[model samples]
Target: MNRNIFIANRLREVLLNGHWIANTNYKEQLSDISWQQAIQQINELNTIAALTYHINYYLRGLLTAFETGKLEISDKYSFDLPEITCKDDWDKLIQDFVKNAACFIEKIEQLDVEVFEKPFFDEKYGSYLRNIEGVIEHSYYHLGQIVLIKELIAQ
Candidate 1:
């Protein structure tokens, strides 16, 4: 398989499986959680919803670059957090997350594998592929945190 295709597929799987860990059962694992459970300020630092937003935010940018062939680096990392304070808002967030995630992967799927080796001078990682790998690692890192927070909330 081509490098970009492989990376894109893995990124999709990462979001599909490792994105959420609020107080949800297996049946609704991807799209089930109370508003309070989502917004609960776990560990005095971040809410579950906040972390989820952060994950999606970075992944969105990563995939955007692949599709557009432009390295759109952010001037500032300024996402507050995911806040589904009401049922309607929660449902919208869920829908948007699913839709945007698929769209993001589609973007990544369209990229040329040769671009992966191309260097992005402004980005710390030196190459586009490294930056993308950072995106995946960042998601998994927080995913672990989300899982731990869910376990704590369940206790």
Candidate 2:
């Protein structure tokens, strides 16, 4: 298998299905959470819905980059999570998250391996390979936070 394909598969595993480290991926972690629980704010920590939106925001940006060779996302606006007032809203968010992630994986799979060797956008941002790996790493970091927040909410 191509190395890029392998990495993309790993991305899918971490984002959509089971992963070795956490034994649970984003979707699995969110599977049982209710809308009320998703929007519940514990202390000052971000809600589950917020984190879900945040994850998809970056993923969507990266997907755009891969498809159009340009990225338009900024960190300042990444966490501007939409309000989730009911179960349908939460469900739509989750559905969009899953759809975006799958699209990202597909784009990665279609990428020429040489693209990974090139700079992502600018020299300071590093190579496409680095950014792709960073995205996966970032997801795991937030996944851990989401797990902890869920536990705290449960207690």
Q: Highest TM-score: which candidate?
A: 2
User: What does the lDDT read for residue 99 in candidate 2?
Assistant: 95
Q: lDDT per model, in order?
A: 0.65, 0.90
List model 1 lDDT by residue over 3-82, tens digit each: 87888766675676433333332113436567678777766867667766676666566556656767674635535654
Q: Worst ten-residue run, lDDT, model 2?
A: 63-72
lDDT of 2 by residue, 84-127 (tens): 89999999999999999999988888889998989988888999
* Cand. 1 Cα-lDDT: 0.65
Report the Cα lDDT for candidate 2.
0.90
In the order shown, the candidates' Cα RMSDs to the true structure are 4.2, 1.1
